[model samples]
Target: IAVMTVLLIVVGLTACGKSTAQDLQSNKWYPNQKGQSYKTQFNKKTMIIESPLMNVNANYSVSNTSGKEYLKVNTDDEKNQKLELTQISDGYKAKAINKPAKADDGLGSFE
Candidate 1:
């Protein structure tokens, strides 16, 4: 019984440890802020920002620093732009970090 219990616990923890990359690839993400008309689709290492005007491509990565997770989006004009997310009922509320200000900080919701 002891061995079985330990095995179950290990399995449960492993299942809950889903990588952010896997979550990003699951669905297209929408913005939760105002005046932003773009959605994002994620590949293995890239994010496609789809807008009415044009589609922009960028690289992205997920990292954990000091027990907090951050999503880093890199574009032509920006590099290693970090966003901290708080999980809500339906999605994540993103806040821009390591910046003075941001207009793109919003919720990352999937449909």
Candidate 2:
């Protein structure tokens, strides 16, 4: 009698778990679109010469331009820059605008 009771309890729990999972899967959550803009700040001091060592503030905006969707990122720092990324098949792609030239290692080869 105890073994039968334990088996019934286990079966009930399994059914409850499956039902909860299905309910969660049927309901999808999406972000709010009421002109919401996300902002982020970063301050870092790096020993590596390749990395930037400064305080930076970035703002992200999502909107549609000319019927195409884009994610815009604006940064305020030494190199004040703006980037607009467009969604591609595999990932996003953005053109490098107003970028500085690569430094040469004095041997005509880029470092």
Candidate 3:
């Protein structure tokens, strides 16, 4: 009887976890992860989310279309500073043209 009860509890927990995961997936902020459609672009290669918390994430990608490689931008990115792409020889690389973050400017600045 005890073993059966434990198994039932485990199954219930698993079901709850799955439901929570589904809820997160329904959120608009969540990244689109459907069939290689998670491509995103940003002006600084890093996006700063204001609400909830100060979250930062980098988004970029490159793909060849009709013998021409094109860089795509994320719709969630800000409209003020549109992400620009530059072509290179072989493949694509994300480059940082802006100065480094002031918080990380110095090694001992935190001290």
TM-score (all chains, Cα) for each model: 0.74, 0.29, 0.23
Best by TM-score: 1
Question: Local distance difference test, per candidate?
Answer: 0.70, 0.34, 0.34
lDDT of 2 by residue, 1-111 (tens): 999999999999986763322322343322112332222221221111111343333444444568654333343322323234454444344333333211121101010
**lDDT, candidate 2, at 9:** 100
lDDT of 2 at 44: 29
RMSD of each: 4.0, 18.0, 17.2
Q: Which residue pairs collide in model 2, if any?
A: none
Candidate 3: what lDDT? 0.34
Better of 1 and 3 by TM-score: 1
Candidate 1 clash figure, as a count: 0
Give the range of the ten consecutive residues with the poorest summed lDDT in model 2.
102-111
Clashing pairs in 3: 41-74
Return whichever of 2 and 3 wins on TM-score: 2
Q: Please provide, for model 1 over 32-79, each residue's C-alpha lDDT reduced to its tens digit, 9 standing for 90 to 100.
A: 455554687889998898878878787888787897877777777666
Which whole-number lDDT from 0 to 100 does residue 101 have in model 2?
Answer: 12
Q: What 10-residue stretch in candidate 3 is worst by lDDT?
A: 102-111
